[model samples]
Target: MRHLKGGPEPDKHMLRRELLAVRNGLTTDDVREAATGLAQHALQLPELAHARTVAAYVSVGSEPGTLALLDALRERGVRVLLPALLPDNDLDWGAYAGEGSLARIQHGGRMALFEPVGERLGPDAVTDADVVLLPGLAVDARGMRLGRGGGSYDRVLARLERAGARPTLVVLLYDAEVVERVPEEAHDRPVHAVVTPSGVRRFS
Candidate 1:
């Protein structure tokens, strides 16, 4: 696969639109097949194997599916923490009890999200996680991730850093989403690995 070269720079907004179009184009069968494969590959990660607590999210729209992995982790007795979006776009933590424990929430004009309906554990709760499964549009060879522009995960990363948390950071995406490079800014940091339906890639 051709990696992106550092030069005049690519338009992130345009790139996002293009990627989203591809994602939205996936058929229901395509998404389900990928989701099953994604769960298989993600569960093989050594980080997850040793993790007692994992911070993850529920997939919405065409995002790479995570429900299978979440259920598997929960069944293993691992503490699975889900996020609830704050008005400021930051996140608060909540424990995932099961499918019955989630509540659909509509934040303004955004699509409804399935959030945990348990006690609000506050933002700092994520610091206790051993692994954090991030949601993104793409990740470059350098492991720098391109998010959906909401900036919620950015704050989460910052909080983890401030607390000196060394949780293994992982992003979930389609195989095509792993590119040679993507646009970057000062605050951007590389993820430790990415899990696709095809397999997993790790970075130093």
Candidate 2:
């Protein structure tokens, strides 16, 4: 910003706006095809193959589709934990039973999110995950993620750290979202890898 010496590298806020705009511009078919491809690639990850538990989220709107992946994981007998947004912007964990168990919740004027309909598992439940599927607008060459400006996942990461849970952290994204640079804060941690429709890119 104005405080930078030469200039500001593209901050996370700016990157998020640009990436989200592109996602919003995609056609229905574009989103659908990408979703299928995403599932195929993600399923191939060895991390997910041996994972007994995974912490993931339901993709909303034009975000890379995750419902397909979620179903596949369940079919594979992986215990998936999904997040429900709390009033304080923290997350509450719950088990993903199936599509029938989800309730669409409209948070204030924000976009509606699909969360598990029953049996809240409390926040610390994420410590049980073998892998954590993060939702982010982009991941840079240095592996720093550009999130949606909500600190919810950041909180999750912090909790995992405090619990000494070393789950493999992964982020799902469209191919173009793998970028060369993105802003980072002191609290930001690099994800272990990024799964794109084209392939999986490991940063760690």
Candidate 3:
């Protein structure tokens, strides 16, 4: 991927900080309303509407909420997969039965994450998903996602590639998180689309 910034470009760390700061300011009501809109708009995507299995994550802190989407998908009889963080920051998959199926986990000093409490499906299980909903701070015009710098989903994407799996990659975010550009690395892969509270944007 090309580093396509115009002027004095900010690195991923700086961009993340700015984005996170804005998110940290959102109120509980703001997050709740956005979560509802996110689920409604995301459910309209043909990729997700027809998918039998979807690999998604639970939202934490001020990140765009995904619980609404997850519950909606489950109610549709879709087999939802959630990730369990491995010791190395790589993700392992598990089925999402419901809200009760998740357990809170604090990865050392990192923020607490709501992860699946079911049987571990191993890292490669993501290859079986028809759609993979990624969590990100922002998605640029190129559909390139700016993750939280954990590199966990990076490993998941690589594993899917090695298995020759072609799942529709989607990221859920707030309307403001859709930006003109975001910093990208050589290993970065653009997502197929991003579903925000406003609507969906696709990339070629």
Candidate 4:
């Protein structure tokens, strides 16, 4: 996708309205079923299937399915790393060996996360990553991501750009969460592809 330095500021009110519309449209059972199907497709992706190391997020909110995918990756012998929210609102990645191995760490406000194992690293870790599954509030066909207004992934992905490496960025979303356009900002990062229960699609 062509990189644009700045675009119209996303209409926060409109965005919220759109998000609520999507949220209200789906039942909890619908989300679970979609997530399960998406997880299966993710495991079948050639890159992910053969990847030695992968970077993923621990799902929060009403995003798509991830727990099963994490387990599947582990079963395939892929080294999985999860992002832990840090004190400064930056992200640090660590290995997700298992639930028993994860320690509770403070995250985004009062939220607690299972801290991954080993030394914390930045997005340069994406250099060796075969796959990086991103969490998004919504994603458009152009790969634009509407995050939770945190700008955490944007900052990290920009750092990756400075290092001259672009790992495959995949956004995991429920089918309905995929939209025609998600408002973008000057600092927003674009993903390479989006995966849903139906299948994977190149965003650009």
Candidate 5:
């Protein structure tokens, strides 16, 4: 397994395009089945199963669907927090009451996102979570995640670090997305695990 300290960081732009192409090829049924499997696998994690507050996201496009997992957590009486993208790319969190609690909002030219319609819980709300479900394009052997380059989660991680929060960080992906390597930067922190349709893999 290649580590960031030993290998050159691969070209992230090319990797993003390549991964997007693969995801784009997935049909609606493929995405639906994957979502079901992913939810089952993720729910088995000890960290998630025991979590009281979980910070997660609503999946868009061909991304690994998260609605099933989010709904399941809510059904378990766990407080699920979803992100609301701020103007500066920072995230403000809100509780996930249910599918009906979300409203579609178009942020500038970006795709419309389904966000909570309740009161904004403020950015620090994430620090209270026991688990955080991160959205990513891929994860390497070392658990370093390749995000969409939006820098939203970066700020979230940095905030967690600053606040001395040590929540269990998890990424949702398809089985193929867990590769032997992904470009790692200085700010890239290894995740605790990656949950996929096939199963789960953990890292130190």
Candidate 6:
């Protein structure tokens, strides 16, 4: 696969530096504003509006906002699924009916919110999703995503591709995080598009 250049590889040290830089340069208000704008842009995407089912991540750390968009999607009658990290670090998905119905499940080092409404399929379940909103530490113009060093999403997306999943993979980020390039591994999964506070841009 073709890769872009310039952005640093997101190793632990680089990630720490970048995170600190982001934290120092942006205030809570700035983050909230950017996240709100990015969420709006994502909601406005035609792919998101037309998607019958979507797989989205529950934001951790300083990622973009998703709560309002998720509620909006539910209001529009869309089926939403959130990733449930399994004991072995693989992803098990369950439908997200609403916040009240969600139960907390422990996996990896974090808690995943889940509902018992949908089929408890393994990683291949992503194949049935119309859209997949992936969480990332950083993303570049070429669609290269820098995950948190755990290959979970990459493995899941690879499994979906092997199964011919046509889901539109989208990465959400703040406008400043969208750079010219991001370091990538051979096994990294490429996203279809990226949404930032500025707007949605398709990756070539």
Best by TM-score: 1
RMSD in order of candidates: 1.6, 3.9, 2.9, 4.6, 2.8, 4.0
Which prediction has more favorable lDDT, 2 or 4? 2
Candidate 1 vs candidate 2, lDDT winner: 1
Model 3 local distance difference test score: 0.90
For model 5, residues 150-199, the per-residue Cα lDDT tens digits are: 99999999999999999999999988888767888789899999999989
* Per-residue C-alpha lDDT of model 2 across residues 107-161, encoded as one tens digit per residue: 9999999999989999999999999999998888778888999899999999999
**lDDT agreement with native, every candidate:** 0.93, 0.91, 0.90, 0.74, 0.92, 0.74
lDDT of 1 by residue, 1-204 (tens): 234344456678977887899899998888888999999999999999989999999999888988999999999899999999999999999999998999999999988999999999999999999999999999998899999999999999999999999999999999888987789999999999999999999988
Point out where model 2 deviates above 4 Å: 1-8
| Candidate 3 residue lDDT tens string, 1-204 | 122344444588888888899899999999999999999999999998899999999999888899999999999999999999999999998999999999999989989999998899999999999999999988888898999998999999999999999999999988878877888899999999998888888999
* Best model per lDDT: 1
Instruction: State every prediction's TM-score relative to the real structure.
Output: 0.96, 0.95, 0.95, 0.83, 0.95, 0.83
Q: Sorted on lDDT, highest at the top, how do the candidates line up?
A: 1, 5, 2, 3, 4, 6
TM-score of 3: 0.95
Q: Model 1 clash tally?
A: 1
Model 6 lDDT-worst window of ten? 1-10
The residue ranges of model 3 lying beyond 4 angstroms of the native Cα positions read 1-8
Off by over 4 Å in 1: 1-8
Candidate 5 global TM-score:
0.95
- What TM-score should be assigned to candidate 2? 0.95
